[model samples]
Target: MLAELKELFATWIAAVAAAVEAVMDRLASRRRVVLQEIDGDSFTARLGSVAKGAGLRPVSFRLTPHGRPEPPLSPQWRAALRSSVVEVQMRPDQVLFREVDFPKQAADFLDGMVRAQIDRLTPWAAGEAVYGLSPPQPGPHDRIVLMLAATARAKIQPLVDLAAGLGAASISGVVTVPADETAGTTIRLFNTRLAQAGRLAISIPRLLRGLLIGGGVAAAASFAVSAYLGARLDTELQDVQQRLNQRRAALRLNQGTSSAELLLTQRKRSSASSVMVLEALSRALPDSTYTTELRIEGDKMQVVGLTQDAPSLIRLLEQSPQFTRATFFAPTTRAAEDPGERFHIEAHITPYFGSGS
Candidate 1:
């Protein structure tokens, strides 16, 4: 059980690692292409420089307002733009900038936070404008300061469309920086795209595949456990049934009969017998008393007879060891033709006198 759990954990970890590596590789393959809008009429294009170990050099180009080649780009520039991730810098007047202070904890969610503040900081509502922010800078007290940049979606969409028409693989964003400061912080105005919006869609199938594998493993383990428990319970039930059968067999061998038959015989011997009760009554009653009807049910006996002295019969029956609690059930009366009174007596029969032993 422990080993199976360990294997499952290891499998999940490996799956997660593989998914992370795949996403990282996809991001690394994307090239950064920058375009700085010089004026409404012209723009400068450049390939962002690669890191030291990358063994690549930067290439630059210029394009007219109509997207016609100014001097004609080299083969490398054309190739780079075709597969590159594009970013366009808008002229300062074309974009709006605002400085806002927020809680430190909101740093991670600045894009959404800044978007919510767009209508308050600018004339445009959040949906009407395309907006982005600079990296948060430390502020007074515990707050953070950030530069928010926004432009009308109408103004930004044309540039984005142009970049796409020029064969850029994806548009990264629009940025704005102060002209005087060479190292001025750039604030992004828009970065969201249809493809980037659904980036996680690529990982959905991979995640589902992993979940299915894990679910299958769990189901198989559960089935194995259920089968094992069912077998164990069946074995236990069989063992109990076998032990009960053995006990019954031993009892039959010792008693010379099945348990039910032995119980019936013993009950008959210990219970009241009609014949034995009659003999006991005969000895208890006077000669003048004669029984006409007698009935025995369970431990109770009833007698109907003609007696010279009906009341005396109760005392006589109670004194006998075979009967108890004797009493007249019917009123005693002298009959016109009979020599004695008609009487009915009821009593409990004792087990001792009826036992054959």
Candidate 2:
């Protein structure tokens, strides 16, 4: 159970970090616009300098939430259209887009759907963005598109409302250029202007045109995947917590278990015995050798010091009643930091039997 909790914590942390990184990536670029669906087959977008000269092309695809690409869309999704759609003309190195529209009801439905998806996107983003949609047609299969980030919505809303308030015709949909097409253009732009930092992620749609095309199986798969991932995450978290707790328990076991009163009684006796052993070992050491570092684990002692002769040090340790076996782990050596030789030795002290450790 403890192990599972720890794993859950780790996964949550990782997911949050991923979410933050994605948001930061967007904010790190100079593009701060997004496309949003307005009402049936109508949408709006903020075209930055890159798309200022580009044109739109017709394509079919599905729109999905960030991170979770498999979330289910409403069955009525097929009848919906983007609120903002645009018609573009491209030639040579120049491009231009003109907005278009669809039925009001369809456009509104699509706008709501897009909004819901953005709201649910994880690792929530701050600031506003715009989302533009493309005009779609009734096809033999369902179609979906990648919508813009919700963060971009806030930034674009005022302009959109202002345009609408001015009695301008509703915008018909927008499109995003594929990253592959933009390849390195952004990089060059950034290098040329080091002060520029904003997001430029494209929001291309992944349309699944046609209704009833794998409708049942695809829906089932989404449910299955969500359930499986949720369950697996829970199980993993439990396992990790359990392991951590077990490790903690094992470490505590090394101290041995006893009642509080008994533990206190044993500690006093153990302390005196340790002091006596150290004093006895110190007195027996050779006059020419000095103890530098001493460590005791159980009945084993590791002594590090320097001596005129290694053999003489061994003999002196052997003369102590508390010590039994003496071994040299490393030969005496001179250190660069200090102009003196150092020796490392190991020995086992005979614990007085029947006395509490």
Local accuracy of candidate 2 as per-residue lDDT tens digits, 173-227: 2334344443211110000001111111111111121223468679999999999
Clash pairs detected, candidate 1: none
Local accuracy by lDDT, each model: 0.74, 0.46
Q: Number of clashes in every candidate structure?
A: 0, 75
In Å, residue 351's CA in model 2 sits off its true spot by 2.6
The regions of model 1 sitting more than 4 angstroms off are 1-30, 40-42, 49-78, 104-109, 162-167, 174-176, 179-183, 192-357
Each prediction's TM-score versus the true structure: 0.46, 0.24
**Distance from true position, residue 320, model 1, in Å?**
68
* Clashes (candidate 2): 75
**Across residues 89-174, which tens digit of lDDT does each residue of candidate 1 receive?**
67876677777889998888787677777889988898898877777889999999877777777665665665555576566456
